[model samples]
Target chain A: MKDMIMSYSDLSSSIREPWHMLLFILLSSWTLLLCVAPPATWAESDKITIYSYSSETSINNFKLLKMEFDSYLSRFGPYELQPVKKREDFERYTKGRKDCLLLISSWHFGNIGQTYSLKPALVGLRNGKKYQKRILTGRGASANVEDAKTARIASAASDLHTKEALSEIFKGKDVADRADILTVPKDIDALMSVSLGMCQYALTTEGSLEDLKQVNPFLHRSIKVVAEGRKSLLLILAFPESSGKVRENMMKLVKIVQHMPLDPDGRKKIKMFGLDGWQPFDSSDKLTKGD
Target chain B: MKHLKLTWLFCFFLIVSSAFAANRMPKVLLINSDASVSKYGEVQEAFKEDIPHPVVGVNLGDEKWDMPSVENLLYDEYPDITYCIGSKAYHIASKYIGEKDIVFSSVLNWLRLPLTRKTYGVSNELHAEMQIMLFRYIFPDVRKVTMLYSKRYTQELFKNAKDKARNMGVEIAGEAVFKGRNTISAFDRLPADTDAFWLISDPEIISDKKGLSNILKRCEKRNLPFFSYHEAFVKLGAVLILSVDNPTIGRQAAGIAKRVLSGNKPAKNVEPPAGSHIILNMRKVKAYHLKYNENALGSVNSIVE
Candidate 1:
């Protein structure tokens, strides 16, 4: 009986408004449904491909950064910032492509001559002298660095900073001559190689000693940074000439990220990654000579 | 009859979907001292999204473990299991975790935190045991090790350090730097006959305006080897610095999270930091003329004479 009454009330209400009332309810819902999060005009497809120079912090820190940068770069039409793990892979992937950016982490700063724009980001003041923060290795290895004449030292890709850092450490002795200088595919690969017996010596940026230790306590005991470079010049973002459109877009994107509200969650990632702030790559400074 | 059939089908679908959703959600809680040395930020990054459970910084430095308000807030939250990251957090959570079903990974003390055999059957507090064993392995010749801490922080860490040192044939000379303005002076007051000092940086050590440089310089002049938390202290005149990272602690803490949620016992016996990451400055070592293996110097992080 209750059902019968409800059906009659529904019939009378429908009869009062008929098609006009039915159409009004339908259209209102259609508009409400449309108010979901704005459609992503850009996605990973449109994401700008960036060369991430990374190693030990890759699993914990890099993934977070890739996510943060993904969100940051979403303002541009969609694009992917791909991280190549090694120098060999980067060379293979980035060759003939101007859209890719070159990133050499400061941990591998022994390559002082392999330039990443010698700009000072953080200074480690010790005994009235400032040294670049660097991660180190070759502490407990058969390829002993201290007095060994023939030892291979690890750094980032063959950039000016890597070349420069090695020059400073090896000093008068021809480092490239003493060691069998083998370059790994990625920044972490170089560090790992030194840690795991694939290579002997590894040098990197200043702030990353804790990161390498987190990977394995044994690795922590096995390696220690030898020399921290003079940190007067700050490392900068670099790019090739072909990355013209992408570079312009990324720098513009960085400018906006500068103003974006940083959350505690977000800052956790920024600090772990050791990014001082983003700067656009100058035309002359961004490109590196082929390794 | 048709309407009733449709309703049954709808309810069946809801049952299937809801089961998947409920099973997928994770329950996590934090046990950090405070923001000054908090690892909460990284743990959140590791597992983003608030999973129906509470995450609090229990030992905020201002509140002690026994404070009623702090205790109530702790007991009020329904943390299925707890993850204690810092020593201070471990101090407070030890009581709470003891009362409930919990699993903890990254405490310096695995033996003290209630490592029971019923935790998934036969148990071994390996991490805790490993650190002690590593200490023995690293310094086989050591006989006496002097340590210092505040009495108020409780004898938990003090006792553990003592036991670990003693088992390896080391006699401990622990000095309590009690509540007073001049704490370093208290450390200095310890018997001069003590062999070496292991300076674990604590609220007592860090809060002192009386720089440890004095204590460190004294150690250097006496040619005493200093074994400390990090190499920074070794640089400041300690013989060596041995420690690990904060995020690794977070990940290890998460591994405990898995066991607790699965109804396993909380508080597995843990070990101290291992020997693999030891730092010995050859310059400093040579100053002491300690006669360490030449192989050890090759693996040092930083060497300051």
Candidate 2:
């Protein structure tokens, strides 16, 4: 409706005098129909509630995803997109809800899935593969996990996934107990802390470091990946146990998303989320092993 | 009834087709920070030729280029994007442009400038890593270099330089100077075994007229290799200067402008300057009895007699 209002000037400028009255009548009818009339085909459909665990500050990104879903799944039925900022908010939003879908991180999936009984539906793919966490250092520098012992390390250990990856690399030792950890905001900051000599080592993911290098060639020439950690699923679509009809609708939603036609706008929206497309969850074995 | 229905369908199709009519091309506004600077002209020329859209040029330093005039032009022209040539122009454009995409160049101390995701630029100076690499190329045998810089001007570069110098097997004995302090002793305390003296491009360190001559005399007496950031300093006996390729910077700005115009967000929100040339002083090479690397000599852009 907002898009229609914005295009009114273009519509008025291009329509000729002989057709102006007819164009006005058609536009008026269209607007009136949209405002007052609801399509009966969609009126009785259940709302497929999609939720994401992104913070309020990152609500705009989730809004873009919501917009994409609204455009693609209008045929499915009515849907509501909600971005839950806090863990407590998400917990509250998911309490006893069976028809809701979730976009959850791997860390949350492994750590909190048992209590929620969240069944994985689909996963986001970056070039048809999963991403892995990596430890980086200066080129030609030592590439040992033990090297982090005496050296200053840059990582956001506050993040559960980073802490888990550190535990994996350091033989189940807590990150806080091992080395000097500088908790910066983003992966780029951690990588740059190593590149700038503020720290001797940095811990980030493979895809993130690749993105940083692509942006800055100097970082590419100077920084090198020293250690690679376990592969982590980036984004997962999941749902709680629901009735057969609701669960079927959820599956249909997943299939629709997985097979979404990549029109230019659709492609742009997915690219905004740093994903190529959606795929079926193939990390069940890894998820079990991690558990 | 059939003819009336057909006419109604025709009117609806015409309205729908009108919505898809060709959109107005976004105009480009070129802003020059300083009228005296030659790089602005090169950027304007390159931008005019390279950008595939309507363009208008304005210099902030001009008498008629005040805020009101700029605001009026913005209202009249409605540029979708602005290409700012230098720091002053960038500051003005950034203040008034208001959410329009901007690609800026010829900016010194780009790190200090406030920028946005929509704002992108080509920095005026070479990356500190590259600068340190060039230093190693010219004086491979010199392991430790003395440096004088201000935290205000080059703190980030100094931090990057420490990492780069370590990788290149060089060490920097950095003396941090600032306003309202005794900075002379910092220069006097240069280690006896220091192999070279690097004069960073910060006015705070060399703004004192007497202090500049004193430092130069001391370097001459010590017979230390003096590296500088300005080519004019080479004529005054510094070894060489790392000069940014001004014309190349213009072209790089054009490339960024083109990308933004083509609806691609800048890959990097901030970019270090791309091209640099070594300006050498042949007399200083002879006076200091320095042996140059063959490859380094081959890469020199000009030699001052």
| Per-model lDDT | 0.48, 0.67
Listed for each candidate, the true contacts retained, as a fraction, are 0.00, 0.00
**Per-residue lDDT of model 1, residues B169-252, tens digit only:** 567777777553556676677667756676765566545545566667777676678777655665466666555433333433
Candidate 1 lDDT tens digits, A128-185? 2222344345655444445433454545435344555566666644663444443432
lDDT of 2: 0.67
Q: What value does the lDDT take at residue A172 in candidate 2? A: 62
> Where does model 1 sit among the CAPRI classes?
incorrect
Question: Model 2 misses residue B82 by how many Å?
Answer: 0.6
Q: Lowest-scoring 10 consecutive residues by lDDT in candidate 2 chain A?
A: A54-63
lDDT of 2 at B116: 80
Model 1, residue B243: displacement in angstroms?
1.4
